[model samples]
Target: MITISGLTKVYESRGRQVTALDGVDLHVREGEVFGVIGQSGAGKSSLIRCVNLLERPTSGTVVVDGVDLTALAGKGRRAGKDLRRARSSIGMVFQHFNLLSSRTVQDNIELPLEILGVSGAERSRRALELLDLVGLADKAKAYPGQLSGGQKQRVGIARALAGEPKVLLSDEATSALDPETTRSILQLLRDLNRQLGLTVLLITHEMDVVKTICDSAALMEKGRVVETGTVGELLATPGSRLATELFPVGGAATGPDRTVIDVTFHGETATQPVISQLSRTYNIDISILGAAMDTVGGRQIGRMRIELPGRYEENVVPVGFLREQGLQIEIVEPQDEARGAAEGEQAEARDARQDESQIDKQDAAPAATAPALVKDGAR
Candidate 1:
């Protein structure tokens, strides 16, 4: 429902040009929660702002539902009437619940309807409907300060939906909330997306938010999109940094004699006891160093780091067996302790052999130093 092509935004500070979004190309499909993740200065906020023309791009287009917002108002600093009308269909939820402290919950939700010239009765009806939709129907009279952070965000979400938007733009809406509250808010977003068939574009530095609710995600770094794809596609893609970050597996230290491998599983493979099968098939004992398992969008996803008894070369067939079972595997370097143990064993074997050689030499020395048995003719 949203298409951003070659979107670039730049600002001036101290007479120097600062680029916030550098040629970002992103697409959000209908009824899907698409997440943009990055660090503090990775241009996540800039990308979201440009989507709604909150920050006009220096170049490129922002098209929502076949309407190009950038083309609505000619390169101007302020939004015109046409741009404002277009923005009404695109709702936004801010990081801080930017509610009017003076207004009650119902008035906060009705503010958008009032701006659109909605009648008092119609506004009241829509406000209550949205309040119920966001699970805050009972808080219509509650003030912002009277509610918890989660409750206030619910009001923010309810207010954003007052205009019946087709697309929802969320800018760190759950950043300030606690972990338990964050999950509830994300679940609410997911439910709203499914119920209303709304397309959502959310930006956050938190990976948990994306993992829990988003079907597709993109990673931004230094004002550029580094990677973008469906969650399953990224997990299957080799060397996918987003996938690795989403499902982090601790690395096990290895040596020349030992093997460390990471195994990834999704779908049907996740239901199988692959580790036990490998142990039974290869007859090699395996040690699990670290693992992460998650149920995302009702699909089981897992990553595990395991250590095998032998080196990669010796366990090549076993690794191949894991691949045959439809698991992604990555071999990691051995740690120092394993390498040191191999060296120590080699040194001890060498010393034992040298000691045996010395004993044999001493036996010969006794024969040589003592009177040897002479031949009979010689005696």
Candidate 2:
């Protein structure tokens, strides 16, 4: 488990102070895969680096497994012996597979154990065990250049686990891989989390990563966390930004007299014919503008945008009826100028963030792009 409070990191570039983290407060429960998502320059990388004291926070406390790392880190850039010992319990996987090119895969994994003063025989045994654990037992003698991107990452993961860390910190571990490779890597992480009871905290710009493996997630923007919750809780929340982004249903009121609303389905309701039931009970025709269904945390979840044949006031009874059946509903078109303008502004902001994310991806080295969908899990 990890807990960060009032965490702020500031950088001085060219006589100007730029804040990377702005009083961030986050908590990751034991044995849970937590994700932090945001566009470029959103402080996601900074926050993760701070977790391992790779980047010392300007001010705040970081507690891991009840040990206050900030306190152990005396007032300096260099880590003290206590802090170094604490860091050995936290494993980090980088976006770029940071491995020693000169060393073989087995040697790379043993490097950490060597640093920890592990004996030569024990290190060899442990390295082979880890290589097997990551499904790379046969490639232990291969060099980094000899392996594929996914294989290299597996080696990186095996190296990180050499110390048998209780927590795993992933910094865009799958960003550079192809879609199929990314999915494989995510599945590996999930398997490790369950098999080893590891607490994973990963930061990525890709929503598909969160949808696939994250048990809980936090949305960061402009150096602050805007939203944080369990995937199911976010899905069930009315007007949830995370929920809307995960299952984007687009459409607006087609006519002035119609009321457009979004309905969320989860748990029992996701499998039920709730929409048809509502239509038949009310004896009114409904128009579905958009819809999306996915699974999150082993549960089916869905969202739909529907148009009713009346104003918001006239549909109050029918909306209440839906709510009574345990559905989360939000009136997208309320026929109020101020509310509509606010919604429009929110939509614009979302589009701008998405565009920025796409630009960031494009600027990186070319790789196969994947659609943002939860293949084996839900968001």
Candidate 3:
């Protein structure tokens, strides 16, 4: 298992300190494909860099398999044998297929073993076996320049595996490829994850990457992890900006009397025809707005948006019951009237909180023979 706690990174640029990671806490289980996803500059690159000690964190602890890696080399940047040993067990791949254009595929794949000083004959034999494993035995003699993008990635994956690594770090290994090539590469990663029982950590900006390959993932925004959940759990979470971004199906404008809802079901619940149950149980009509069925990590998952008649409060019981049935239920905004009421309620709540805060501050005023507010603001 990999455990990270209070991970932080800060850099001085133009005489100002900028924090790239803000106390990130995460756990990646052994033998599982985990993903870190975000828009550009989300510090995904920084987090993964910290994992391999490619970029040592400014603060926090990285414990892998019960070893505190930050203490490597007794606090100096020079890693002792412990750090080198740990690093040899962790392999990394890149967005670009960082292959030597001049070398044959077999030679490229054998580079890591060679670096470890394996015997020449053993390196060649092991390289062939890896080629066969990746279904690239036919391309053993081909140079990277002669292969397609997907084939080159296969080589990259093969080379990263040569050290018999327990962990595989894939950093945007598919974003540069076309869709079909990306799909093939993802399948290969999944197969390798299963075959080697390799704990894989991949970072990507595309949501589809997480939906396709990762069993569990975290969504990052501006260097902060906004949310982390199983892909299915994320899809089922209501008003999830990440899920909505992942599955952006079309929903049209409807009449004021019509209500819209987004529903999701997983595993057995997906096949239960719960909408029909809701209809039969409540005698209310439902119009299927849009839906899609897809599997993630081989788990059946489905999502749909439906239009329900009348106001939200009128169908509250039926909706609440659906929630109890373990279906993911999201009420799409009602018409302007309902929207206005919701906004009004939220504004009133905000006003109430502000009023309470003001009252509390007033109550505290007499007790303050106090420090100046400006200078003591942080307190």
Using TM-score as the yardstick, the better of models 1 and 3 is 1
Ranking by lDDT: 2, 1, 3
Off by over 4 Å in 3: 73-79, 249-253, 334-379
The 10 consecutive residues of candidate 3 with the worst lDDT sum are 366-375
Task: For residues 199-309, write the lDDT of model 1, one tens digit per residue.
Answer: 999999998988899999999998999999999888878768898799976644544577888888999999999999989877878889789999877689988889998
- What TM-scores do the predictions have? 0.85, 0.88, 0.83
For model 1, the local distance difference test gives: 0.89
Computed on alpha carbons, the lDDT of every model, listed in order, comes to 0.89, 0.91, 0.85
| lDDT tens readout by residue for model 2, 146-179 | 9999999999999999999999999999999999
Which one is best on TM-score? 2
Model 1 TM-score relative to the real fold: 0.85
